[model samples]
Target: MFRFLVGRLLILIPTFIGVSLLAFFPIRLLAGDPVALLSGERVMSPERHAEISHQLGLDRPYIVQYLDYLWKILHGDFGVSISQKQPVLDQFFQLFPATLELSLCAIIFAIIIGIPAGILAAVKRGSFLDQLVMGTALIGFSMPIFWWGLLLIILFSGILQWTPVSGRISLMYFFPSVTGLMLVDSLLSGEPGAFKSAVSHLILPTIVLGTIPLAIIARQTRSAMLEVLSEDYVRTARAKGLSTFRVVGVHALRNALIPVVTTIGLQVGVMLAGAILTESIFSWPGVGKWMVDSVSRRDYPVIQGGLLIIAGLVMVVNLIVDLLYGLINPRIRH
Candidate 1:
């Protein structure tokens, strides 16, 4: 296991380097100049442009700039955000917990709702319940998150007024951001109604963000369970007079989970990508919204740095998922 972990860590070195290269080059190729965008409405004079360029090392050759960026990254300097006027890493860390909280909640929601739905669908294959579960999963999978989020806002927030439209919490709450996670921070602050406010604000966006993953996980689980249920071991368990629950829950589901877990692991990337749309729609203060803003302003450091950091995070999640395989099924550790 140690050797396996070491090997995976070693693989990430080149993977991260490749990600850095991809993040760095593409942003520079974009048409808008970050310095010019930084000037806003004012026309940037040549001197002003040169001054900003020099300050940002944009005056340097592409190769030199790329090398310098990499060197700084190696030294733990993500460079300053031209727009925010803060360290890129600092801004990222500040926003990351919000994204983490949302993604974690979204995944948890998916797992709790999806897995059981899947198990039921598998147990009653070809029945109305199976069709209903599969049909809902299909529709959820097909729905666009942005559009769904808008519809939700229109119905729940606009018409019914059941949830807050956007933001992490109601403006009425003044919770200090201890962990940068609104839910946790609100509870810690002991601010009256803050936790409830946070949860209410979270519900719409969480549902929007989690929908696709829930669909995917449910389908994956159902498929895996169905395949596992047909195996000889499952039949043996049944023939041995094991309770239906024991046969399916202990034996079938456990074996089915290996592939289902892999599917869930792969969905981490999908979740992050989906968060970009969900966060933007919900105005959630997260790395996704930050990246979108950076793109508009052509904030090169933030864009490149954010992409690299997010990509690295995805890779880390995938590695952790791979490690989890050993825990779920010990044969993989060999």
Candidate 2:
């Protein structure tokens, strides 16, 4: 287990460097200058631009800048945001809990619904229920995230008034962010309707973000369950007079989860990346939305730092998944 973890960590370093390269260089090549953008509607004079560029070290050669940034990253410095003029890491930590909260809820929502749907679909493979589940999965998977979010917002928030269209909570309730998660914080606040408002605001975003992952997990689960159900052990369990639930859920699902676990692990990365789209639509103040805003203003530090951190997180999640995968399969540990 130690060697396995060490190996995974070793693999992470180079990939993380690649991610830094992706995050750092491309944004610098973007049209327009952050220096000019800083001045807002008025264009800065060339002399002013040069002065600001030199001050911010933007005048340095691209290779030099990348090397310096890379060095700082190794020592855990993400530099300051070009636009916000704040430490990028500080902003990231402050906002990350929100993204983490949303992503956690979204993935949980997917797993809770998706796994069962897949299980039933597999068990009743030839029935209408199976077809309907798979059909819905197809639609959910195919639908664009932004468009789907808007549709939900219109239906639930606009017409039905079932949930908030955007933001984390109502402005009526204010509380210090003790844990950074609104739901938990709201509870701690002891304010009536605080937790309710947080949950209601979260509902649409969770549904929208989780919908695609749900489809993916459902399909993956169904496929895995189908394969496992046909295995000799599953039949043997049934022949032994094991109950149907025990035969399918216990015997089959235990083995089937090897691959399904991988799918769910991969979805964590996808969900993190996908949050950019969801956050934008709903105006959720998370890393995704921060990255989007940074792009518009060509905030190189924020963009690079945000992407690098998010990439690292995705890599870490994959590593944990691999460790879990080994524990589940056992054969891999050998």
Q: Using TM-score, give the best candidate's number.
A: 2
Question: Candidate 2, residue 74: CA error in Å?
Answer: 0.4
Candidate 1: segments with Cα more than 4 A from true spot: none
TM-score of candidate 1 on Cα atoms, chains taken together: 0.95
Clashes of each: 0, 0
TM-score, candidate 2, is: 0.97
lDDT of each: 0.92, 0.93
Error of 1 at 326 (Å): 3.2
Model 2 CA RMSD to the hidden true structure, in angstroms: 1.2
lDDT of 1 by residue, 63-121 (tens): 99999999999998999999889999989998999999999999999999999999999
The digit string of per-residue lDDT tens for model 2 on 29-55 reads: 789788988999997889999999998
- Cα deviation of 274, candidate 2, in Å: 1.1
